[model samples]
Target: MRILTKFMLGLMLVLAVACSRTPTRAPSAGPGANPQLGDSRPHSWTSGSPYGQAVHGIDISRWQGNIDWNRVRGSGISFAFIKSTEGGDHVDPNFRRYWYEAAQARIPRGAYHYYYFCRSGFEQAQWFIRSVPREVGSMPPVIDLEWTNSKTCPRRPSPAEVKREASVFMDIVGRHYGQRPIIYTTVDFYRDNRLGDMRAEFWLRSVADHPRVRYPGQRWAFWQYTGTGIVPGIQGDVDLNAFAGSRSDWVRWLNTRLTR
Candidate 1:
């Protein structure tokens, strides 16, 4: 009877230990936990990581080449920024097709213009306005500013000159589209041109770290976290961006920000 009691006690103790042990839990498949967003060159983010944000998007141009918009939308892409015009006359070869396909897929998409330092801001804005239609329910226009090492036109204007041109571009485009233009810029361009001083929503490029770390004291609408992103429909690598808000916040932003 004593042996039986000892065995029972041991069994009880074993059961108790088992109960006390923490159960191995499956990883959460909640918002921001998307398996589709694979990066070719992934960054180990510490603080201010964009992965936690629920609203994610992509920016594409001709380089992406014949995208499957349906697959892209299904792969958890909430929005897109299609490259429209560059310089004073150059239009992205795939802009119209991408715009139509993305709309058909029900993805809220915007158009962005690449600012060329060689041309005046007015000329660039005019080119962009001419190329992209002022469609209702579309996302706002964007001005992409960056210093290039181009052999043709490698003019690095002063901060004052940069700001002046940027303002002109934004004002002209904003008036035409009836929505404020968002500035898309790199860390080097932002710093060199002192873009933080501008009163415009920024879509910043910071692949290694968070935009807050790269562009201190700057409020950003979108963060381009990875250029080598492997989206489902995109042929090779693509730029992945994260909106700076929750899902609900994203909805609210779109409602208020989209061009009328």
Candidate 2:
């Protein structure tokens, strides 16, 4: 409880700083990966330190700064999720380069399609499926559903609508990807869409709300606990995330599914 509270306090500071900071390094290059400033430690975490065993990966879109795959691999990066497309027609230009680069670098990678409430989820997912080919080694695709475009009233879809749209995308991508696609969401968006029952691997965002564990009583494979992270091989700054299980879990999961 104490640890969680401390993280929340840190979040309050991060949000304030992120407002003025230009989002030059995020998936979409705008509000999606805004850096949280003002925190005592710009890049810090309360992780229990997984003894170099757990899976370490990153989720990137166009706005997510410059990434050097070689440098990242040197630092023990095992996997990554690159944003491929958004809405039904807008595909990320950086994804094509990054996806192939990661694959060439011999890294386990996955592609994600951001769902736009105003567009068709199925179409967006299909677009991603088409854009990102089924490579020899590929992680399942992901659905990124978050409030967008500056929280505009008309632009923001209703909570109910978001849920329906998310389901549509999930189902479509799930069918095409051959596995359950992961769902990436923040606390606010997750609650608004009631995503707990969606039935897929969850990638929850929690930069500061650590010890407290915001997304309680649920199964999650990845927890993005920090956005104020500065990593080598990535330009400017980047978000940091960690897997929820031990090294054994990683080896087991990979051997079972990716060993084909």
Point to the candidate with the largest lDDT: 1
Range of the 10 consecutive residues with the lowest summed lDDT in candidate 1: 23-32
TM-score per prediction, in order, is 0.87, 0.75
Q: Over 4 Å off in model 1, which ranges?
A: 1-32
lDDT for model 2, please.
0.63
In model 2, pairs of residues that clash are 4-211, 4-212, 25-63, 25-65, 26-63, 26-64, 27-61
* Candidate 1 TM-score versus the reference: 0.87
How many Å off is the CA of 184 in candidate 1? 0.5
- Model 2 residue runs over 4 Å out of place are 1-53, 64-66, 150-154, 257-260
- Indicate which candidate wins on TM-score: 1
